[model samples]
Target: MAEHGWLFWALTSAVFAALTAIFAKVGLQGIDSDFATFIRTLVIVAALALFLSYSGKWQNPATLSVKNWGFLVLSGLATGASWLAYFKALQLGDASKVAPVDKFSLVLVALMAVIFLKERPSAQEWLGIVFVASGVLLLALRR
Candidate 1:
């Protein structure tokens, strides 16, 4: 099971992401999306803090390499921007439509990995990416 941990976690993430769209759509009612995103961020930060503390995984940030800090900071910025945009989109659009479009990130990530990480996806994997991209286009361009 441990060897297949990534599969399990990836499925779990998808479940939670589905829930996130539903919950965020409802929660956005009568509130500014930016404030809602801030509240969500605070909750996530507190929950992760507690989880790390309970799991004894807390580490000194000062000990990390500069490269680690740099990339982590960049990743955090990207995540913040993504969350802000997602929340706003959910506020304005149908969650069913918005979430699928947001998942176009899957195709973007595969392309980025190939370009920046020099990752070589097998033909089968490329086919999957193409399918996902096509699906996203279908959802996004539909009337």
Candidate 2:
């Protein structure tokens, strides 16, 4: 691991992502999904700008390679789409249930990466994914 420890960043991101769902669930209580997404994005944009200013690391990209531009735009759109749908889900169900179902996308991505990307996982990783799927399934049986 690097001196800063990538695991710390990963865990921080995970916790923030979970809390984002909770906040969106509460904040979007009476708003339409589209409007909620707009509100969230605007606020996030302002926050990002402020943080960049404070950190003195803001940069203007005057040139981008075609491939890099394509990847960046596609990734940004995919992320926005996910946030939109996730907030909608959070709005409609219990936070615990909605969060688990949304998180199942992780398992879905793992499977899809194997099938489409030809990515392989270790035996233990496969077992852990299977457990994740089973637990998610069991959640549906709860009253």
Candidate 3:
């Protein structure tokens, strides 16, 4: 919130989440889940490379430190692990149930930001969280 530019990222992320659910459903229809994830990584790496090139930010390495590299590697590992677990979860459980459980990461992140960055959600953010949580829960509810 300090940087209003993050608003765009937040909006984009919401779209990405919905798209991910729909596309993952279609992807699971025929593709091997692990193979699908591996292929997606290539797409992501290519997209990132393209973004860096287009932004003309590829030349700059000074801003990144060893810790940044460590974090990036860790993040990639986490992503791969989560993808496997998620796809398997979807195969076993209802997507609506699995999705809301997954969305708890949002709450975890908010708490982590408060602890690590001393950042607090504003009133609007809390309201957004309420709506997000409610939607997820409603989705999870059995008819």
Per-residue C-alpha lDDT of model 1 across residues 7-123, encoded as one tens digit per residue: 999999999999999999999999999999999999999999999999999999999999999999999999999999999999999998999999999999999999999999999
Taking the tens digit of each residue's C-alpha lDDT, what string does model 2 give over 1-143?
A: 58869889979988998898878878987789779999889999999999999999887675768898899999899989998888787777888887777778879999999998999999999999999998887885588
- Which candidate wins on TM-score? 1
Q: Is candidate 1 or 2 superior in lDDT?
A: 1
The lDDT-based order of candidates, best leading, equals 1, 2, 3
Model 1 ranges off by over 4 Å: none
Error of 2 at 106 (Å): 1.2
* lDDT at 124, model 1: 100
lDDT of candidates 1 onward, in order: 0.97, 0.86, 0.80
Could you tell me which 10 consecutive residues in candidate 1 have the lowest summed lDDT?
133-142
Off by over 4 Å in 3: 1-3, 60-63, 122-135, 141-143
Candidate 3 lDDT (Cα, 0 to 1): 0.80
Candidate RMSDs in Å, in order, are 0.9, 2.1, 3.1
Candidate 1: lDDT of 112?
Answer: 97
